[model samples]
Target: MSPTMTEQIVLTAREARDVPHGEKGKFYERASERLGISTATLRRGIRSAAPSKERRRRSDSGRYALSREEALLISATILHAQTRDGKRIKTLKDAVRMLREKGAILAARIDKDTGEILGDLSDGAIARAMRGYHAHPDQILAPDPVTELRSNHPNHVWQVDASVCRLWYLEDGLQAIKRDAHYKNKPKNLERADRFKVTRYVVTDHYSGWVYARYVRGAESGENLCAVLIDAMQNRGDRDILRGVPEILMMDKGSANTAGMTKNLCQALDIRVFPHEKGNPRANGQVENGNNLVETTFESDLRFYTVRDLSHLNKLARMWRIRFNAERLHSRHGRTRSMAWLDIRQEELTNAPSAAACRNLATSTTVKRIVSSVLRVRLGGREYDVSQVPGVLVKGPLDVAYDAWGDEHIKVVRTGKDGRPVHYMAPLAKRGAGGFFEGAALIGEEYKRKKDTPAQTARAEIEEMITGERTKRGAEKARKEKRLPFGGTIDPFRGMSEKDARPYQVPTGRDHPAIAPTVESPRLTPTRLAMLLRDRLGRDWPEDGYQRIVARYPDGAPEESIPEVMAAVTGKKATPDLRVVKA
Candidate 1:
């Protein structure tokens, strides 16, 4: 079989590569002439067909000669000089120069024989070293690996985020959509619109991608956040199908989202609040994408329509959200968001409380009240009869919550037999015209007696079992005859004191060996005495004179006897005079 063009080129290139270096041009010319092509084209083809040899590498390849500490120092210096936005203001050369000048880094090379620095350190070397050591600014500032998250069912996890609607603003009770031609680079227009900037709060179900949005005037605040959340959780008719408290709410760690009121509301509804780490917006990327979706699909059309105010904008947002969720097909599920949400089981979906009740839960704390002897508890300036609540006891503490659906009643929470919380609707106690409780018997027209409570019945049974009588008179007679409670069968201190009890032995302490005191010799050295004499006489004394005085004294003279010692040594009355000298 005849060789193909590629194979022929490969054979020619192999022959040319093995030829003598000086005759390479002649070899290429001969090959090109035989192949009936130009020398340049043939040479190119030969070059392309030849497999390149692997380049040689040094033993220390991919390793930095610079120590890790030096590389880290260079990186830190550059990073420290960067701006708040992470723009590097200091170049590698600049960093190297500064560090070299400060004696923070040494020359790149040294002579092994002479022990002298022989090579100058360059910025390129430092940069290469940083890259090799993984201490470069780029490597240090790179984003961390993202963790993929998932949801088990609809409403299992929801993400909420707020963004300013920079394209539109409320002015003169109407929406003013900004145009790039007029407001793109105009600072004055932006400044004016900043006063009426619209903030959009968006929430998305992680599982189904269903979205809910609300627009409000001004910046994000705790009140606005809570209001948006409450509205999103309420059933807004059949058009808007996404409504319920999510099992877990994911949001940015903004002040409004982490506010006490926001946490309290979520807690009241049994929703867990999860705030993403700072500088990690992708942790709640679902809601962020939802924000962009609304901006592009819904708000883009607002310029063609008229919006009266914030309320009108929110109404439009609601309508758009409903249509978007119902019509738009989700890329992941291959179905509309509404349909995907409908796949949730009945038990997995939790119905939200009324708007008024949710608002109360957000703003108010659960009030604790004690039930009165009459089986009534006062809450919100009204008295409610809790006698109908199971396990209700007089003077017992009860948690009271506002009943937004029924103003005439309040909800009471108590522990049930199963150890879970039980809720009850307690009606307002009826009051008579004279401010007295109604249901009392009239003088002659009616006769009525209050029903005995569980506590009252238990008390009567206990009295009958203990005293062998149910009547008050019989109980009193039995108590007098018994003298002591429980028929004198109970002992208050049965095991406290007994005949076998012995007195506790006092612990005796052993005396420790006495330590002799250390006595220090009072004899002063010649140098010390010389210094003291110099200070006392206001003049320096000879070294020999101080030595002679110390020798004569044998035992060191006390500090107070310095004057006498000086007089005895000098053979004259020496009156020591001292004076302070100011510098």
Candidate 2:
């Protein structure tokens, strides 16, 4: 039989290994020719078929002399020495030396048998042990995992954020907050300029990346927040496409954002307010990035251009924002923000109310007032005639909201039969001379009265049943004569009085049976009883043993009777007076 190629290769490799080191190449060349293969192939085959060299390992390989606690202490020391910016000032060796000086770690390991000291501790060894135990600075300081968010549509989610523009302030005009000898970033300079500092409010649509920015003088407040939000929501102009109310408004948990005024505005607009957790600005990163963009792209031009006042700055900002949204291509959608937002369907976009109405909604709180006898309600120091509003009754409490569009009228909110709010615009009542309503009939010329509400009719029926009169005058006369509302024909305490007056025969002492003494037993949980049984039996306890015990004593076993019960279940003799101790 002829030798196989593998066997020839193996024989060649054996011969090559025995050849002198310098002549192995020549030997491989000769073998390649004989084997009808290239020299490189023959060498590779020889290398593969030859036995691999054994690398010796030390006795203490893969072992660390430093304990996990010592490594952790060293890592903690190094971490503690880091600056606020996370720059490490101390190295591992420095940490080990410091720890040794403080006696937190030993300088060397001592042998337990001979008390002989080993070599000085190695920083490299400590570092390796730290990496092995996951106590290194990189491992401990790793960032938490982040979750990416998605938006369904342009107006589905909007992020609003406020940031202080540290560059400029609006005093007489736009002035730079220069960091010079006179106006450094000291407490005095910052405190004096705090009121005049420009706060930039930015709103970004999460899906389209369209940004709306407005510059406000002074610090952030609920009024400023509402003003910016209103401007962003309302129609800007024909050219600007970012308008309408968003379904969800996401912001930080700032006091101004979560204030009652902001909440009321969002509620009135039917927008859900979502405040992200504290210290997590990434939740609203879109707006945060919008702020940065505004600062870099728009505000960066302020150095060359002139900004007369906050209004002027806001005007320029709006213009730049519109152009940017209409021109710049968004990286995510690969189109201009305006074009992306234009994809919104008419039904998906909710048209916002007028600026005045939105402002009123944000600033004013809903109030409750009862309609007067003349079918009027007072709101915002103005009396409105609600007589024309359906379901409104005299002296009935109605939910009234301010009408920002006109001071001559107010909105009356009422719950309809379907449990939804029905709004009515109630016009302000005109008062005639002598404090009478203008629409009222003259004293002698005419006579007119409002129709009675359902409550009034019910009251009239009650009066007729009680005082035997349907007219208000007659009902008043009956009331003056001391007539009760229910006609004074019923007694409320008759049954109680009859029962108190009735006599009952008392039971004789002999008729009562003797009372038996009842013994109270402490309740034991299934696990507790199982544990006790296991400890007493000193053997493996099955789950069925607990089931049997529960079935026998559903209420609980008395502590004193535990021994007898255990003995009976285990088929062993009961111990004398053995009681289970309360744990």
Please tell me which predicted candidate would have the highest TM-score against the true structure. Answer: 1
Report model 1's TM-score to 2 decimal places: 0.59
> Candidate 2's error at 446, in angstroms?
38
Backbone clash count for every predicted candidate, in the order shown: 0, 0
Off by over 4 Å in 2: 1-65, 80-91, 101-117, 181-192, 366-583
Which ten contiguous residues of candidate 2 have the minimum total lDDT? 181-190
Question: Per-residue CA lDDT of candidate 2, range 1-583, in tens?
Answer: 1348778988887766678879977887888899898988766765676674677988977767778888888888899999989899998888888888898987467787998877777777677778888899988898768899999988999999999997898888898877772265477767778878889999999999999999887888899999988888888787778888898899999999988889778866767778899978889988999999999999898999888888899889879988999999999989999999998898888878888889778877778999898899887677889888887787788888765455787877777797645568899998888998789888799999888777877888987898988788998999899877677677775667665786889866564587889988776765576678878777645547877777776666667677766775686765666566766
Worst 10 residues of 1 by lDDT: 574-583
Q: Per-residue lDDT of 1-583 in model 1, one digit per residue for the tens?
A: 1357678888888887688879989888888888887889877776677786777998968866577898899899999999999899998888878888999987376666897877875678777888888999999999989889999999999999999986878887656554863365888877778788899999999999998989888898888999999988888888898888899999988999988779658756767778889988899988989999998999899889988888888888888988999999999999999999998898997888888788778887668999898889998788998888887788888898776456688878666787644568899988898887777677889887556777888988888778878697888899888766666678898788667689788889887799889865454554555566666656445446676676777666655566667776666576655222334
TM-score of each: 0.59, 0.53
CA lDDT scores, all candidates in order: 0.81, 0.83
In candidate 2, list every pair of residues with a backbone clash: none
Q: Which candidate tops lDDT?
A: 2
Model 2: number of backbone collisions: 0
